[model samples]
Target: MNVSKLKKGVLLAAGLGTRLVPYSKEMPKEMLPIFEGLKGRVFLKPIIQKIYEQLYDAGVREFCFIVGRGKRAIEDHFTPDWAFVEYLERNGKEEYSSLLREFYSKVESSYIAWVNQPVPRGTAHAVYMAKTFVGDDFFFAAAADNVFIGENVPQKLAELHEKRSTPILAVKRVNDPRKYGIIIGREIEDRIYEVEGIVEKPKTPISNLANTSLYVFPPEIFKAIEETKPSVRGEIEITDSIQILLSREIKFLAYESQADWVDTGTWETFFRAIALSLKHSGGHNIVFDVLEALREK
Candidate 1:
């Protein structure tokens, strides 16, 4: 068995976020805060930061972030602030500072590159922007707005890739397949499928396995993206690109993840993500208490 290890990651954060409205008007959706806890204290961290840290924990040392207009905040947040850490330490807040310190150490030890996507061409285009950075390496291509709260899905995907040595797509069973890209595949094993076809937001659903925007892609993905034409929405969809690869006999595997897949794209999902994160952080009781107190007010 040929074992492969992944050390490169590409994060796509270049969406217009028209659905998020005012919250995303000035802030990138990827920069939206998610609840986190350490040492019995709750902390708010950006979703993209969480994604990066999770991937880092999975042994990915090189990162390429694709950003669009007004997405400079994502880049800025990734830049460590020593003065803030020092100020926290000065105020006897070692816990908060320690978090920053650890995060900064990870950033300092890793290679992070930013690529500008001037136009909102689509997901495939955003991924294509990292072609030069990734360069023939099997890397994790993830959407910054989405994350798996309780499990390190990237590490699991890497492990599966190591065993199979094929392109992998993270999928989840959804009740409403019309809102997501659906996958049609032959089940090879438990929670594993040989992906035969994938379609974006199909009118007539074929499968409930929705694409989760987490992928372990090979270098051929870039070529597939190049050959992919625009979708009905006039944007290059990553599903279409994968379908192109499928046509050429590029085998892909669909891994149906059981982890809590949180997508902070729309208002409903964003609120749900916050709730899930709070629950994961063991802070839901505190939130419930506050809500009850507010109810008395």
Candidate 2:
């Protein structure tokens, strides 16, 4: 199968996010602020937007956003605001207006369709909801909570998928394997795992390579998901389905990313992501400048 033919990407953002409650009580977890500036202004962008931008850069022109009932904000953010954009232009903000217009133009070009995940099902169920949209081909999948940052991680993943013509799962080496889905396998090369098995949250993990919620799946995955039964937790596990596929001699390649994996599902990881983003945004220096100004006061 030619992976170049696979052009669709699915973003899973329908989780209830019970872990980040109080904060997530009003806003979707995907909308959480991962960065802020010292100017008292927040430089926050939805997780989905960042993932979408990466996919767009990877030649993925179509997207299916799997959202739940309270995820209207996700849809609204992607929707074009032509009227407001024109208003900005009329008020002598042509630069800002043009930027927004260009953004809307890209949104229009990108075929973005929203699929509802009414129930708080597992990742497999959320992905299965987009099967009809995927048709008979391979597609990309990324969790909204995990942001992959690099020069061209998405494009590189797409290139690998096209070369191998198989499902490619993104992974990162972590010191603590028990906290994530650990991928156990022989290292064929540096940072490349053959993926003999994937153990989700294992007490005694065999490897430190944790699955980072990025995947390139073929259409057969939909069948595997259909055959999958709900686990003891009453949620259909995507890993179980992928294991079934692996048992059938299907190839699951593990591609390691050099970029940092920021998991924003918890308070600690969320703050870490904010700090990293701030450092990248030149806001760290701004913080010191603000501190100096306050001391001079």
Question: For all the candidates, what are their Cα RMSDs to the real structure?
Answer: 1.8, 3.3
- In candidate 2, stretches whose alpha carbon ends up further than 4 angstroms from where it belongs are 1-3, 35-43, 92-95, 290-297
Residue-level lDDT of model 1, residues 1-297, one tens digit each, is: 223489999999999888998878778999989999887878999999999998898889999999988998988888999999999999999998999999999999999999999888999999999999999888999999998898888888888988889999999998999999999999999999999999999999999999999999989999999999998799999999999999999999989888889778998998999999999998989878998999999
- Where is model 1 more than 4 Å wrong at Cα? 1-4
Clashing pairs in model 2?
Answer: none
Candidate 2, residues 134-163: lDDT per residue as tens digits?
999799988988886534567778988877
Clashes of 1: 0
Output the TM-score of candidate 1: 0.97
Error of 2 at 258 (Å): 1.0
* Leading candidate by TM-score: 1
